[model samples]
Target: MKLLVCIKQVPDLESRFKANAEGVWYNEADLAFRMNEYDEYAVEQSVQLREKLGEGTELTVLSIGPDRVVEAIKKALAMGCDTAVHVQDAAASGKDPWQIASIIAAYAKDKSFDIIFTGMQSQDRGSAQVGVTVAELLGFACTTTIVGFEYDNGTITAKRELEGGIKGIVRMKSPALVTCQLGLNIPRYPTLPNIMKAKKKEIIAIPVADLLREESLAATTSFHPPAKKGGGIVLEGDMADLVDKVIAILKDKTAVLR
Candidate 1:
């Protein structure tokens, strides 16, 4: 079995972020980057299959970003993917969701993979568009939010996650794409030995231009950080003052209550 998992490197939210001078995107120079959380599930799903399918299964991770993203790719390698492909392109930063999908589809179209795994959405941009878009572009069966499933006889039966704890099941043959959601499987950290082995594994770098030749379908015009959260109002007083504060707050919230 040959599996391809699309991975994304996103900013570690715990670190500070600052926008570039143009305000189009974050200045990634000092920010720490990690694999998208959901993509980790996708990677784990691909790796877990190796236990069942065994020797013949080959898992490959693919990512589209600048060179810095390779750190995240190496982590996936250590996690158990047989190899990786890095699509390096500075233009990727400004491209919109469809443009990004187009780039991936261009390379994936020729790859002849039986199954492709991807995160339901990226952490930096929660568009949730790339997986399905790539499927459509490549004419593959696509299902998102797969929480559980099984594969047999070159067919896949997946349970899709729906709102309110409900799951929708879908079945499809091989050469399909699946967007992994949380709870699919726990992602394992790469041990020290595996980390060392990953350094020797194959990592093929492809220029983004080779995948995307046309002008970007869309572009980023402006971006800004979300506003800081406000501190909650604290009530500190004796009984009389507390009562007055509650009444005043309720009255302020309700115009007629005044």
Candidate 2:
């Protein structure tokens, strides 16, 4: 089976973040970059599938970003991916999701992969649309927030989480898209030995511009952080009094009542 896993380099969530003087975005110079945490689950799933299928299967990790993103791909290699492709260009710096989806879709279209997997959401933007968008672009059966998976006789059985504590079970053929959530599995940390092996793995660089047919998008606005919120005050009183006070506060602070 030829499996393609999509990964992204994102600012480490635990690191201290600060916007630059222009109040547009975070300072990149001192930021520690790592693979998006949810993507790690996707990679772990790929590794598990490879183990199930034995040595004949091939796994490819793909990501779009600047040249520095090779490290994120290498981390996947350390976890036992066979190879990686990095789509590099300055356009990756923009926050436009469609631009990213288009570039990934264009490259992935011709690959004819048996399966494609990605994280449920990107850490930086927290937008969970890429997997479905790419799947739509590729005309593949797609499932997001997948919690469990099983394969048999050229068909895939998947379990997806849904509202109201329900789980949806689906069956599809190969050449499908699955976006993983956090509970899928625990990602393994690469040992030093594996890291050494990963250093020798192939990391292919592809220019994003070459893959694109047009520069169809642009980001014209930026952002500044919201003001800090004040501490909450607790009130102790009888139930009727508390309800009246809560109603008054809600009426004053919001337009919820008729």
Candidate 3:
């Protein structure tokens, strides 16, 4: 099997964030970057599949970002990916989901990969559109939010999370894509020996401009922190008195009652 797993580098959620001066995105100046949490599950699941399939299987990890994303690529390598591709773009942060997906689809279009793995959503944008868009562009069977996975022969069985705590089971053949969700598997940390070996792994760099088909369909106009809210007012009285107090407050403060 020839497998490709897409990964991303994102700001650590614990980082202190501020809007950029242009008010279009977060200020990345002081942020710490790491492999996206969701992508970790994708990487782990891919690695597990590769191990199960053994020698004949080949796994490649891919990422798009500035030079700093090489760190994330290396991490995936250490986790047992055979090779990696880095789609380098200094302006990657400014690209919307469609543009990002287009680049990935363009690159993977001719790779003849048997399966593709991606996180359900990116942590920074949480758009959750790229994987499905890539599938659409490539005409691959796609599944999302997959928490359980199994492979047999050329077929795959997946358990997907659904609304109201339900699980949907799906089965598909090769030449498919799956967006991994949390609870799929526990991600293993790279050992010292694996880390050393990852340094020797191949990381092929491709300029983003070469693969991009067009400009983003959407653009960010403005980004701002949510407005601060006032403290709540507690009404302490009998039911009738509480009702009267609520009406009075609404009359005084809002247009609804007035």
TM-score of each candidate structure, all chains considered together: 0.86, 0.84, 0.89
Q: List the lowest-lDDT window of 10 residues for candidate 1.
A: 213-222
| Residue 149 shift from truth in candidate 2, angstroms | 1.5
Summarize candidate 3's per-residue lDDT along 9-127 as a digit string, tens digits.
Answer: 99999887788888898998988999999999999999999999999899999999999999999999999999999999998889999999999999999999999999999998999
Question: lDDT for each of the candidates?
Answer: 0.89, 0.86, 0.94
Question: Clash pairs of candidate 1?
Answer: none
Pick by lDDT: 1 or 2, better one: 1
Tens digits of per-residue lDDT, candidate 2, 194-217, equal 999999999888888777764545
- What value does the lDDT take at residue 234 in candidate 2? 88
What pairs collide in candidate 3?
none
RMSD of each: 4.8, 6.7, 6.9
Which of the numbered candidates is closest to the native, going by highest lDDT?
Answer: 3
Query: Model 1: per-residue lDDT, tens digit, 125-157?
Result: 889999999999999999999998588878999
- Best candidate according to TM-score: 3
